[model samples]
Target: MSTQTEHPPAGGGAAGVAEPGQSAAPGATPRQTLTLLTVLLAVFVVPTSISGTAVALPDIGADTHATLVPLQWVVNAFNVAFACFTLAWGSVADIIGRVRAFGLGAGIYAVASLASALASNVIMLDVARALAGVGGAAIFSCGSAILSTVFDGPARGKAFALFGTVAGIGVGIGPSLSGVLVQGVGWRWVFALHTLALGLVLLALPVIARRTTEPRRQGARIDVLGSVLFILAMLLLTTAIVQGSQWGWASAGVLSLFAGTLVALALFAAVEKRRDHPMLDLSVLANGRYLALCLVPVAASFGFVTMLTYLPSYLTAVSGYSSGTAGLIMVLLTLPVFACPMLAAKLVARGVSALTLIYVSLGCLVVGDATLTLFGQNVALMAVAVPMLVTGAGMGLSAGLVDGQALEIVAPEKAGMAAGFLNTLRLGSEAIAVAIYGSLLATVLASRMRDGIGDFPGAGDPATVANEVAGGNMTGPASAVDASARGDFTDFLVRSYDSAFHTILWVLTGICLVLFLIIGALVRTSRDGREPSAATGSQAAG
Candidate 1:
């Protein structure tokens, strides 16, 4: 494979896989598809592994006497490492061979899982989780690159859809599966299962890479300094976001982190400008069309993250549902996500821009969320199901479409870098969205509760009244409380919570509507960028 020419064979050596108009040996059996699938699936391991651990937090704390902040870091450690390294690993895979790099990541992930399973303390567990993040970065980064390298045209679209669908399912199922596994046996078994999956994937590697052993010569050098700067910038920014609620947002530590992020980011750009082969090619972002495509995920992710972060609370607090039931309700949002990618793939094949589909999906989400806000209590079970289905479908469609399309735009040699760039933006978007939108919802909920209670005549001593109402100990009708006599005895907390949720939904709708307009504009440009019908057959005619 190395003896082959350094450059991609004319119409061959396509990104992820061979595509129409790309070079390929005649009658070549597709070898990398399943390999790519396995790699992508490996990305789910951390989520699946750690998800079970969350349910065991109380047990863990009881056993280890872990403090709240330290215990919280157990989760944040993985998130921080995973989000920061995704692009870095993507870039590294581009420099090396994707398979070799991905396999290495899998090995690390497997070992880390085992270590975490056997951990005797919180510090050790956090260390193992961070290591798993490092491995996760490798898996996710190259997974996308591998898919892009192995498939082309409509096939590529469908492959990405499948990948996204599976990812959504893995995340959704993780907690439940983990809980069940932990109950039936123990939490250690969760990580042990990952080791088993790792072994299987490793065994399949040879077959998966049979036709893809050729090393790509990208003539690009790794910009290590730039990567370091980027890591710092991301670390500071993400840390600030994650800790601001617990820490005083105005504290010097938080302010210093914010300042550090800006400085590191600036330094990263300067360093990359001087590097021969930068870890991230900032030029890709200069393309207006690409920038617009990038915003599609960044903007919509706010709502996606918000829903995932806050909805469970809604379920438990207001809907009177159990934690398990709340988990099931969330499935309404994630289950449909898996199917949307496939649908979007079909739509993309039929002259639709991927961005258009993402827009449609987001629009659907806005509708579903709005419906829930306005008539959530009044709607029947089937009616409730309708919005959830729409939300899930929209998420599915939006998740993977741009990824596939973005990879398609770049040359085969640049696939890794492109993948890294896209993933970096996306992961950052999701993290920021989760933090920012979550805070927004919190603020709104708190404000609404404060204002609504203050206006209620006899709800004296707001904090005490709220505490009593929340605890479900308040007696007498909520409306029966006379202005003068209802001191600290009001009982309409659920209704107040509902009103706050309603306000949040309206905000989401407004944001989605704006995104829709932007998406519509981007669709026009994306359509123009695709190969014309005449160019689709035989040679791409580039």
Candidate 2:
């Protein structure tokens, strides 16, 4: 069967797929609808696993008797694998068919989820989560490529908006759902539920979508060396950042990891430039507009996504809230995620420029991060809620448009590679952000706690006490010096956390400001200095 490239316009057309004011092609509606549903379900599954599993970390730790390092790995292992493999999968999807790759990925994800649920140890759980990330890479890489290929013009914008909304729901509701599961049933149910949902998606995929292939160069080869080098670089960098506090920043091991990362990155760039069919088209980076599109998400991941991962931990550990209460508080951070994407889509469809929206979003992020620095132990929930909403709105606006905008400039045939590259930056930066943020928090909290505990009688080893406090074990024997010291230590723990949180917020605020200026300078505009119409249907796809 020949592949159909002509999508129905936003208004009613030959294709029967009814978008707003549009009609689908004859016999196309059902397949189009099913394809969309499958992608949405696949997209929703991965992020839900990410945020939901974060909420269940405490439970996972308790049940597995995991230490701080192993617990961090449980989260980072997934992130690392997801980041490392997305670009590789994107190329693989293009060489094979997107639908086939997506199906295989869904199968892998479901199996890994089942394994995660049945894991008897922390190591086993980490391994399962990492495998799930491999699947997540394929799903994320192909999902956008498929959507980009299937939809065009205003329909594409609307489809991505709906896609963003689904993603928002997953990010917003996952923690709350996980809280319910962890509290009412068990943490294991979290993975079990994902397994069931994805299993169904896998079964329905073949029926919903037709197999389609992209035009590929006859001698094209996957850049295996580039992939290996990039993965090694990311692995070493992430390890150095995550373990810097524990290993001591100046220690030989941490320094060697950092050095190795630099060397690997250099080698990867060298190899990619020499290859005819590079995993990533480095030429894409030369385009200022595309570079901005790619890098903005990296900055946002540092400021926004990192906060999403850690805020729940803070709410439960430092603020003395239950996991359920923490989830409720997180709603403030996620609700706008669902709302802003649709708003952005409507605005773009009405001739508003995506560049303008991106600028506004980044501005919100800067303001939100700066505002969060003002929070303290006595700060009201509404205070945190306000900044979170602003940040969430920023995330929502950009998340929907960034991928679409990046794809606008790329050739349709290279859609998979572009999508993979975009996500590689997005998720890779997120993984690094977690490490950097975690490092800063650990280092500052330990130092502050050490100073606060200085000269306290019978407070054996300030480092040990600090570790216990940082780990949220405030009532343990390590933290209890005596009756009189207990109250002081409690006060110190709260104060130290406040200090660390403030420091992180301030640093993120700086990052946001720097990125805002850089993006403003880099993104190209029309001769009149107005935003370009590329994000709308005005610009033809390459």
Candidates in order, TM-scores: namely: 0.85, 0.86
lDDT of 1 by residue, 142-194 (tens): 87777766665566677777777777777677878878877787767877888
Query: Local distance difference test, per candidate?
Result: 0.68, 0.76
Local error of candidate 1 at residue 247 (angstroms) = 0.8
lDDT (0-100) at residue 349 of candidate 1?
Answer: 80
RMSD each, Å: 5.2, 4.6
| Per-residue lDDT of model 2, residues 1-542, tens digit only | 12334433211131222342234332345556677788989899888887778779999999999998888788778877888788888877766656777888889999999999999999999999999999999999988877766666676677778787888798778877898999999999999999999987888776645433233323567788998998888788877766786787789999999999999999999999899888777765655676678888887887788788788767766788887688678778788888988899889989998888888889888888888775666678877778888988878888768787777665555567878988888887876787778767877887887765674677766566655565566677334477777777677777777788888888988988998888767664332335443322223222
Scored by TM-score, the top model is 2
Clashing residue pairs for model 2: 11-22, 12-22, 12-23, 14-25, 15-24, 15-25, 16-24, 16-25, 17-24, 17-25
Which candidate has the highest lDDT of all? 2
What's model 2's TM-score? 0.86
How many collisions per candidate?
A: 12, 10
